[model samples]
Target: MSYFGDIYKGIKTLLTGMSVTGKYFITARKGAITQQYPDNRETLKMFERFRGEVVMPHDENNEHRCTGCQKCEIACPNGSIEIIWDRQIDEETGKKKKMIDQHIYHLGMCTMCGLCIEACPTDAILWAQNYENSVYDRSQLTKVLNQSGSKLKAGVED
Candidate 1:
């Protein structure tokens, strides 16, 4: 091709790109591609399957299904889960039983890989819908999953 032909081709390509941009600019009155995050916070919705963070759900009696199996702790790649357990004498059975003293989860250390939830045999841990995991202090990120003054429910298999 001639030098002029090459120049014409370049200009034609540039015009095609400009035309697409111009089309969008002209149609901007219809709607926007960008979301107004802060303004739309009240109506903003997340997907049902969105895995935000790990949480232990307790019943009205404050009883949880965690059996202190430590499966979640073992599955966590980032060492986010720590299950502190001890042998306690069951009042009914009068036999020593392995019970969880505390279930510590470090939100900051968690990569949200969902391995811990999947490994939970008792369905004690699940992905909560709450997406806001930010905290001002690092210490606040480490949370004890068991509620205060709560104990293992009766009849929970040892």
Candidate 2:
């Protein structure tokens, strides 16, 4: 009786899987599930919530919002983010302030967890919509988020 019951359950599971596959197969001609890569690159659109890569946005004046808080680095489960920062004297305040020299992001080590973006207090970092990140050399994956000569945006408090 147990053997017959087990066989019945197996058949039910198989039929359930086949039904899902058949449904997709029937609709495959009308609307294909997968897109044709390279050819449809121009028409391809990613979902809004898709996490591609971490990026720091700089404005026209070459200013960023990152205050070198290192919160993103701390939140990262893996050592993918590295903030090289130092203390500098603010010309206006005339006091020592933390400033980021370089905000490094290693794409190869990133898990696309979005933790770093959440940890940022000033909304300095965000996920870039572009998904074409493939490269031949591993060194190309390591990126400096901040542009050259980019300074902290004015009025952005730490």
Candidate 3:
């Protein structure tokens, strides 16, 4: 009957699969193709296309290029941007100006989509190539970028 033929075929298929696995099990000791990860961290390389975390550079003048335009904040679908604005007297005009008070980044919620970089008018933010972002504490993943206590210069903002 066809049923009996199917049973014999199944048994033969099982044996064929077992033979392949047995060969690997016996040959595993010969040499490993796997590259040990942490042991060779110095030589570890990532693709140039990989997108990483965003970073902002603060200058000595305590001025960030971010013009409070909120283009990036608006473009983000998840609303992850938390920009704290503070009023400061513009040194040139001696008038109160709205500036970026603090820029907080929550890495846990970021998708690394690179949308924020394209949305930036001044190109103040960029994706750094360093990708080892693992950490034990979730709170530590949150980064504050304005620690330099400096203002951005004219015509250059990210």
Query: Against the true structure, whose TM-score is highest?
Result: 2
lDDT winner, 2 or 3: 2
| RMSD vs true structure, all candidates | 4.3, 3.6, 5.8
Query: Each candidate's TM vs. the true structure?
Result: 0.74, 0.81, 0.68
Give the Å shift of residue 30 in candidate 2.
Answer: 3.7
After best superposition, candidate 3 residue 71: deviation in angstroms? 1.5
Question: Candidate 2, residues 1-158: lDDT per residue as tens digits?
Answer: 99999999999999999999999889889986788989999999888888999999999999999999999999999999999999999888999999999999999999999999999999999998899999999999999999999999998883
TM-score of the candidate numbered 2?
0.81
- Which lDDT values do the candidates have, in the order given? 0.86, 0.95, 0.78
| lDDT, candidate 2, at 12 | 99
lDDT of 3 by residue, 55-110 (tens): 87666666667776677777767766677877889887799887877777777788
How would you order the candidates by lDDT, starting with the best?
2, 1, 3
Model 3, clash count?
A: 10
Better of 1 and 2 by lDDT: 2
After superposition, which runs of candidate 2 have C-alpha atoms over 4 Å from their true positions? 1-28
Model 2: ten consecutive residues of lowest lDDT: 28-37
For candidate 1, which ten residues in a row score worst on lDDT?
149-158
Q: How many residue pairs collide in each prediction?
A: 0, 0, 10
